[model samples]
Target chain A: MDNLNFDEPTRKELQTFIEREQAQSRYNSTVQNMTSMCWDKCVTGTPGNSFSRGEASCLANCVDRFLDASIFMTKTIQDQRARLQASQPETF
Target chain B: MASRKEAFMNTIRNEIALSNAQELLNKTNEKCYAKCITKPGTSLSGSEETCLARCMDRYMEAFSIVSRSYQTRLARERDASA
Candidate 1:
């Protein structure tokens, strides 16, 4: 609440700080999700003393491929939208 | 007061950090339990306990790996856009 009245510049600074923190938190949650997902997909065997060479690589590749897939899907959808607009220029 | 603003920002940062830690703990607990414990039992068997310990370690390792990969990707994308 307004328990602490922040001046205009201070408020703007705090807003920027919060936005940065939010971006960071979003990145962190994505990592958390990818970790859980890749752990399941890449780590099939029982937990050993340490990861095998293949397992380690698989974990790394999983994250990269997952992000690639996300970007690809977004691009695909945008392309589809562009195509639709081109085909139907007047359609709102 | 300037001190009050500093204190408020510190509180916000601390809360964010604490929540992040809580989230990691929750995910670790859920994933490790699922991986290590196939069936619910009155007590955790010896093998299940061992599996849980190893699973916890691996989960943390996986988190680090993903964090690294994501950071690398973010940097690459930023460089590309710039």
Candidate 2:
């Protein structure tokens, strides 16, 4: 509302706070997505009293391997970019 | 003015929290329904109800495990980059 004006420092602080919250929410959503995916993959049978040892390990490894894939893809893209830059001189 | 700003921030925080809860609930509903209610019946059978309960617990456990895995990976990545 019009009356909810935050001063410069307060506005900046609020911006940082919201950004942090957004980052956290993003992380949370990612985990939710991963949980659903891995649950489908690892928990094939009916839900039991507890996760089977295989299901538990699958969930853990799923997250780690997914992250590793993400990092590897990023590195691959960066390497390709470097190669492109080396191959062609920058005109603009 | 201070109280107004505080109220505004609280609203934003509450909204974010509310949406996060909503998302989790929706996902849980979808996943459990899929896993538990394979075929719709006149009503949820006793076994279906039990499966739903167990599915919910396992889903939550999976969420926590994934959360821990991601946090550890993030910390490791940060340390490596630093």
Candidate 3:
């Protein structure tokens, strides 16, 4: 990889481009995983021509609710850490 | 030099696109196989094939729906945090 001698600006450009692509790729993978999970939860019946209204709405809500659950869990952990640090301030 | 840089960027872009496509295909194969192939027969029956086709379509649709919902939620969270 070091054999390719790119100019500073070109290297920086490529670096940013790759970073953006990686972020996009990560976003795509999350969607794929959530789709599979929500499909199992909402799409119980055999595959029809189209999704029923209930199933479609359930799929949408499932994503939002899952994100909410993640945020809630993160906050809970942060709060627990804060409390622990407060109680044991000398443990530094 | 300019053309070399273009080629390098194109390679990276193509690799990402290929991997993304492969991931989607593998997932669809796993999911639809589970949903459609209830029993392993001598081969795939006609009804199972039909079901798999529909299942693949529905899975893609579901993916888009999820992507949109997640993007909207992420944007809202970012705004709130800001």
Candidate 4:
């Protein structure tokens, strides 16, 4: 194994890498979740030949739909907040 | 800690990290095999090999796509709350 010591430039690079990895920790979990979900949805074939066009579409759609769900939730919450503000009088 | 035993411990640590990567690789191989190779022939058939290759590609692609989407969602959620 190559020894990686903390020199100035190396240290800076490592710091950046660590930060990215930190962010990626959150990202990695979602990938696992999506893989599990999409595997169930798309990979129905008898594990032979290859993924059909249908399976590929299903995997892509699975990710898109999950994002759609989050977006829908955001809009719903915002609308509720707006309604509450409009109903409250003399708050200012 | 800079003794022979320390060096041995480091080797163990390195092995653990390598094994983790190996485990993922093995899992991906098994999963893609199951997805692409239905029948167990005397040898891997031509079509079975092609399917295995494609399944591996798609799996990696899906993993990356999911990673990106999840990160984007997290950023949006943070902005929304702030």
Top candidate when judged by lDDT against the true structure: 3
Candidate-wise lDDT, in order: 0.89, 0.88, 0.92, 0.66
Candidate that scores best on TM-score: 3
Is 1 or 4 the stronger prediction by lDDT?
1
What's the TM-score of each model vs. the native? 0.91, 0.88, 0.94, 0.52
Interface RMSD of candidate 4, in Å, is 6.2
TM-score ranking of the models: 3, 1, 2, 4
* lDDT per residue as tens, model 3, B1-82: 8999999989988998999889889999998999999998999999999999999999999999999999999899899999
The alpha-carbon RMSD over the true interface for every model, in angstroms, is 1.0, 1.0, 0.8, 6.2
What docking class should model 3 receive? high
Clashes of each: 0, 0, 0, 8
Candidate 2: how many backbone clashes?
0
Each model's chain A TM-score: 0.83, 0.76, 0.88, 0.70
Question: Which portions of model 1 show Cα errors greater than 4 Å?
Answer: none
- What are the per-residue Cα lDDT tens digits for candidate 1 across A1-92? 25568888888888898899899888888888899899889999888889999999999999889989998999999999999999999994
lDDT of 1: 0.89
Ten contiguous residues with the weakest lDDT in model 2 chain B: B1-10
Identify the CAPRI category of the predicted complex in candidate 1: medium
Tens digits of lDDT, candidate 3, A1-92: 35799988888888898899999989988998999899999999989999999999999999999888988999999999999999999994
Candidate 3: what lDDT? 0.92
On the 0 to 100 scale, the lDDT of residue A40 in model 4 is 67
Model 2: per-residue lDDT, tens digit, A1-92? 43556688888877888899999889889988998888888889999999999999999999999878987999999999888888886841
Predicted candidate 1 versus true structure: per-residue lDDT over B5-55, tens digit per residue = 788888888998999899999998998888899998999999999999998
